[model samples]
Target: MSDREPEVVRRLSSYDVTRLDTAITVIQTRDPALARILKAERDVLRDHRNQLDAFATRMKFGSAAPWHPEGVMDWLIAQGWAPPKGLLMAEGEQEGQVDR
Candidate 1:
């Protein structure tokens, strides 16, 4: 008989849910290449989230820090990984005229 242990899959933490959802959406509709990159990143994030959850579970009874849903989103935004939404001026450098 082999003594190999069974692999355990960790559940996604509350904080990770939003990021995963957003990533899935962006990947599905947008660039497949970017999606592949995001999938790899998501795997890493999932691992971190699992570790954090485990740590939180072990410490005391209820002393876990509140998860920031926008944390990853903000990071992606800052990296300019995706195009800007809402406001649009021009493709290149061009000052916009203020409408009053």
Candidate 2:
């Protein structure tokens, strides 16, 4: 690996990352095969986001952190790793919203 790897990756626009993130959501509820495809995509996106954040830090991009997926709970639930009904944020709530 060359030191230029990060510079090459830094070329990835925020929109590119955003599209990957959106794609994950779009396919998250589809057929098992499609959902499986997104699982790998999300992993790659997550790693890319991590690398971007590190690159930003090294370059002192700004006070703002680089973008990252904000769908941990949703992704986990979709993968059946988290409770289907939802996480028990409270006795009568799922993720802090009361179940109706």
Best by TM-score: 1
Worst 10 residues of 2 by lDDT: 65-74
lDDT of 1 by residue, 1-100 (tens): 5566636645455667578668778676768877777777787877667665655554444334343333444444554547457444456645555556
30-79, model 2: which lDDT tens digit per residue? Answer: 76677677767667766767765764564454334433222433444454
By how many angstroms RMSD does model 1 differ from the true structure?
18.1
In model 1, how large is the Cα lDDT of residue 10? Answer: 53
Model 1 segments more than 4 A misplaced: 1-17, 61-100
